[model samples]
Target: MLKEELPPEAALDGPPPDADHVLQRTLGTVRRERHDAGRRRGRVMAATSTFMVAGALAGGVWLGQDTGDTVLRGTSAAGAHLAVQVTDTEGGLRLVATVDGVQGGEACWLVVHTKDGRTFTAGSWRANEDEVTLSGSAMVRAADVAGVSVMNHDRTPLITAG
Candidate 1:
């Protein structure tokens, strides 16, 4: 017959009278650990939210500034001249355009193209004379505008600016 060895502490008659107390202590430890984990999670979430808000504020401020870059300026083969200043605005690209040399009673269009393959109609006007001088504004993203072009109502390209 083989004999088994036992520790001195295992010489109890049966289960300890304090068994329930030990179980309660273990449960209390688990609960405290869970509470600590929840607090940590809440702190992490608050920090992330703060960072997001700061980033949003910074982006808003940046978008409100004027970039001051000229996107296009040229004279068409048919004698239509255009000058444009592109700026980044809160809404989008702010295009201030000046046009000259368009014939009177002719419909002209300003087209803006973006780097992301998007096109926008900025404005339109009717030239009153061959020496017509006019100014207009449009909204778009200065960073996204790849080029600008002036076209007639018949879709003929008058001038293109890059």
Candidate 2:
């Protein structure tokens, strides 16, 4: 331990820092930190809410959906293409069928066959264009559906698929 002496020119005592200013700065820092924390919490809540809503929508879609296919596409031996969407409606089973490559100007029919050996007509239309879309419903459940077909007005099958 070596002893050292202070210079005479050096001021031994300086004025203490202002207490009020220090207090105010400390309070301001605390308030700013608190405000930042609040903003962070708000952002977290918003993210959580968004995720929750998305999960709820996904759940609703999963729970309220139909059992049949959204789309079933097939081609006939005559080269016509058939696409169908089968859904369950309150009235019964609904079928949306799109037919393509069939000869135009012919009256065509959409039919649904049930597992119980019953056939139901869905809709009919004139094949006025290269492709046509038809929609109809039957008073049968999707579980009871056997197959679907598009036929000529004379009941000749044009396209068939299950």
Candidate 3:
């Protein structure tokens, strides 16, 4: 059939009579699609970043709670230094203390007394570089140990019991 005798829809199936107008319309559609796609990508990235930041904050809070049960205290004497740390474990209390700076032949002593006057002392003397750890269900009684004391070369109380 002759082009002039065809309907508008059939005419559209043939090559465009005006190439410039067709090209302009196609380019406009492509630009609009690209803009919409960029907007969607930006939204997705923003949501992902927000989720990451929230997750980090939650992890920090969880870590803080996990380590919140421990307490640490430090003191120094004329010839000795002491550091004490107490933590609540699953079964009982855990107490750790470190002592340093004693005479070459001097001995370090650690004594723990409970509120009921029950005392638990190291049978043998501890060295200056040794770390003492005590664990037991009755360890809660350690709250009454007060503090550790150090003795000097002349058997003088470098750190008084408190």
lDDT of all predictions: 0.75, 0.83, 0.55
Tens digits of lDDT, candidate 1, 1-162:
222475332546743555566666887899999999999999999999999999999999998987576657888887777788886767876677777777778788888878887778888888765544444445666767788887889977788777
Top-lDDT structure, candidate number: 2
lDDT ranking from best candidate downward: 2, 1, 3
Angstrom error of the Cα, residue 35, model 1: value is 53
Clashing pairs in 2: none
- Greater lDDT among 1 and 2 belongs to 2
Per-model TM-score on C-alpha atoms: 0.52, 0.58, 0.39
Span of ten consecutive residues with least summed lDDT in model 3: 133-142
Over the stretch 93-149, how does candidate 2's per-residue lDDT look in tens digits?
Answer: 888998998888888889988988999999998886578877898898887888888
RMSD of each: 11.9, 11.3, 10.2
Judged by whole-model lDDT over C-alpha atoms, candidate 2 comes out at: 0.83
Once fitted onto the true fold, the runs of candidate 1 whose alpha carbons sit more than 4 angstroms away are: 1-67, 130-139
Name the candidate, 1 or 3, with the larger TM-score value.
Answer: 1
Q: Which ten residues in a row have the lowest lDDT in candidate 1?
A: 1-10
